[model samples]
Target: MTKSKTFWAASALISLALMVFAGYSIYGRVALHFSGDTIEVKPVPLPAAEEQEEEKVDTKSALEKIKAAEKEDKEEEAKAGRGTPAKTEVPRMRAVKTAFEYKDSAAKSVLISGSFTSWKDKKMTKKDGVWKTDIYILPGTYPYHYTVDGKKKLAPGKPKAPTGDSLVTVN
Candidate 1:
């Protein structure tokens, strides 16, 4: 090949390779950001059986204290001739079927947790490179996130929560 043609071809190849490398780098960064690599997960140990029993006893005592206080309030109201307070009906909130999804083809397990689940991890089913779960939730906003392979990850494109987690709203 002519020196000029050979030089031109080499330059073109180099340019193409540079472009490919830049494109791959950008893709990797975007993927890592959306995949929740920035979020950290810390495992909390469960309470022991003895501690659970103690908590039950404490709950019983707390309930008894509340009942006693209510009785005292009623007695005082009776003495003041206020009679019994009329019961007001509180409207019940209907639960909406909400779907949560996380995409991670490499993940072996995915779980979702939030105020709705009492912060307990709920397992998600995987299908076609997506992990998903449906939960019946009352109409409200709740902070939540996904646990992919035991690491906390927020759902991509979702709003951020005050606690630095992802937010989900059910209506």
Candidate 2:
């Protein structure tokens, strides 16, 4: 009878120990999951109005200095030129009527792009299955191509340069 009582008591104590260990593990896991076991707080300072004003003053002074330096450089250039207008005159640009034609009847849209147009999409109009557009090009060599339905096509009878674009000379 004594041996049986001791065995029952030992089993109850072991079971209680395992239950306590499992409860502690669950509590630790939940605490770490919710708040990561620590709280971090930081304080941020607000900017002062006087500090901002000082920064503005510094910026203004720097701009004034730059303006003064530019004025001095212009005066020096004027003195070197001996009281005459700056050399070299800008060439007068003229509007030249240019035309392009795409003979493909299957094309849905056509565009003319060149250096004057900044290589942007300039949509052309279709007339009797021919795509045409008039561009006012300056007197220079421009590399251009045609975009027919989102496909790049070089101008007909114009060979592509090493830069992979057909050249056009406006005089």
Candidate 3:
């Protein structure tokens, strides 16, 4: 009888856990449905039949004015080089491929932060004790640095920083 009671208690606990999980899933689905963009519509009763007739009369007058303006637009398009290509020229921008590398054997995380990346920390992956990452940026000069293990520093043999940041130029 003691063994049967133990078995029944275990079964009850498992059943309660399953019920709680199912209830949580249902609550999450209901919360998600109401959380995102929702449109609520309350039915507004239409105007009386006599008031609706007045609206129809005003619409008929407005329709005539719209049709007359459309006819004028058709006439202007016929004279405005309708089938010819437009003479406007669009300016083009090019993207440049650049590689930023840092050689640190003991650093836990190496990041490349620059103007192209909005000066944000972009973590680089380590390979054979050297951290490297490639970035595609626009053709321009950008000043940047390598943040190694939470310290802001530059790579070896870099030029002196007037802006306290090393420059990388892309042409």
Candidate 4:
């Protein structure tokens, strides 16, 4: 066999090995369960008295809530001949310490500014030359970028190109 063909075969083998190892790391060897294993589902416990009371007070069904809101809007419109729409609720913060990773680069400093972050400049500083933040947020996705030397850039804490914003996964 020619040297070129041998080199290609070696490269293919190395790629396959890397893929196999990646799969193993993601799913630990003993983590998988077969049909023989028992299901681990559990029943949810009952809500506390206070929780139940709160839920009762807010017992409007989705349709009921929509209808009530529509009614309120119509009444307001008739009274005012139309008015500005109610302001949108921004997504609240959840965890502050989010990780940024892109192709082969990582974030030096990442700050998020979306409706979630109230569009405020919450600067995420870098510790050990790695972006570290402790911001609280709610359940929602938003556009974010890293700030390097007061310049806007995408998070690069994981693996990605330095020129574009990418998804940053948190643990």
Ranking, lDDT, top scorer first? 1, 3, 2, 4
Task: Provide the TM-score for each candidate, comma-separated.
Answer: 0.48, 0.46, 0.48, 0.30
Clashes per model (N, Cα, C within 3 A) = 0, 0, 0, 24
What would the per-residue lDDT of candidate 3 be over residues 1-171, giving only the tens digit for each residue? 999999999999999999999999888755633454321222345766977899998999898897787667776777785764334365788888888889889999999987678667898999999899999987766667899888999767755344467777676
lDDT by residue for model 1 (22-138), tens = 999888755744654333333345767998899999999998998798788888888999968556476898999999888889999999988678678999999999998999987
Between the candidate structures 3 and 4, which one is better when assessed by TM-score? 3
- Clash total of candidate 3: 0
Q: Name the regions of candidate 2 deviating beyond 4 angstroms.
A: 1-91
- Superposing all C-alpha atoms, what RMSD in Å does each candidate have to the true structure? 17.9, 25.4, 18.7, 14.1
lDDT per model vs. reference: 0.82, 0.75, 0.76, 0.54
Predicted candidate 4 versus true structure: per-residue lDDT over 11-96, tens digit per residue: 99999999999999666533422223322222346767997877776775665897788788878877887676666576755565
In candidate 3 the C-alpha lDDT for residue 52 amounts to 84
**lDDT per residue, candidate 2, 1-171, as tens digits?**
999999999999999999999999888755643542222122235776998989999999998998798778778878888565454465788867777677888898888876567667899998898988888876666677898888899988975654467777666
Instruction: After the best TM-score superposition of candidate 4, give how far the Cα of residue 7 lies from its true spot, in angstroms.
Output: 59
Model 4: lowest-lDDT 10 consecutive positions: 33-42
lDDT of 2 at 120: 76
Off by over 4 Å in 1: 1-91
- lDDT, candidate 3, equals 0.76
Q: Please give the TM-score that candidate 2 achieves against the real structure.
A: 0.46
Better of 2 and 3 by TM-score: 3
Question: Which regions of candidate 3 are displaced past 4 Å?
Answer: 1-85
